[model samples]
Target: MSGHIAQDWEPVVIRKKGVAAGQRRDEKAVNEARRSGGPIETIKKFNAGSNKAATSTPGINTKKLDDETEELAHERVPTDLKKNIIQARTEKKLTQAQLAQLINEKPQVIQEYESGKAIPNQQIISKLERALGAKLRNKK
Candidate 1:
């Protein structure tokens, strides 16, 4: 043909490793890694001094209020409720161990109530009442 000779063309290669091996690569992988906390190796690779300076404000307080504590302080079992449980169990001829089994509670817990060592929550009191077929609360 003419005075110029034809040259064979080859595609340009931008990456030699990772997903885009032997082809063109972009910042997509790097951007994703930055947005999400990337692999462990990448996380450990960074030691940016600017990050510490950026955290100047103290973190928010996440502790919730103690509503249960306040409510229980006022909703205690009546002083004579334990006596009622003892009276009911005696009338039914059921031992503390048997009563505890009926209510799905430990025998020692029943003992604690009889001995006035533990003031159970409302749920336990309700369970005890159901198991003994008695009302342990004072009639008002």
Candidate 2:
């Protein structure tokens, strides 16, 4: 209520020829892929904009940083996470197939996640957290 203009505001400045963050993904559903697992439909949906009519679109299966790329890598749980996943899955009184259906994924994804062989993204963790009514991942 001072002498300040009520409508006083600053406008976002956009520089020409500048690419904004997350612009790298153009409706590829990359976030979905990262969260939902590598489903064939998701792959097709992402690569619809094929410059040269792509033969196949790399989906979640191809994701993850290899040894060559160690800039920002994630470390999978040695045993505790595997146990936690298994325990949580059991506590829900749900089978792998049922859990997959609940999370919109294949049974194999659930198996892999519990086996500690694959990294689960936020969506999966969120589902697990809700189903178990507890946090599943311990982030550092």
TM-score winner: 1
lDDT of 2 by residue, 6-117 (tens): 7868999887885466344545556666686654232346555676555356554456434346566676645766787788878878898888887788899888888777
- lDDT score for residue 24 of model 1: 25
Q: Which window of ten consecutive residues has the lowest lDDT sum in model 2? A: 38-47
Instruction: Provide the global lDDT of candidate 1 against the true structure.
Output: 0.75
What digit string (tens of lDDT, one per residue) describes model 1 on residues 1-140?
Answer: 66888799999979665655323234666566658776422344354765765555535322234233444343344569878989999999999999999999999988888877786677888998898888888768
Worst 10 residues of 1 by lDDT: 60-69
RMSD of each predicted structure:
16.5, 23.6
> How big is the positional error of residue 80 in model 1, measured in Å on the Cα after superposition?
1.0
Candidate 2 runs further than 4 Å off:
1-78
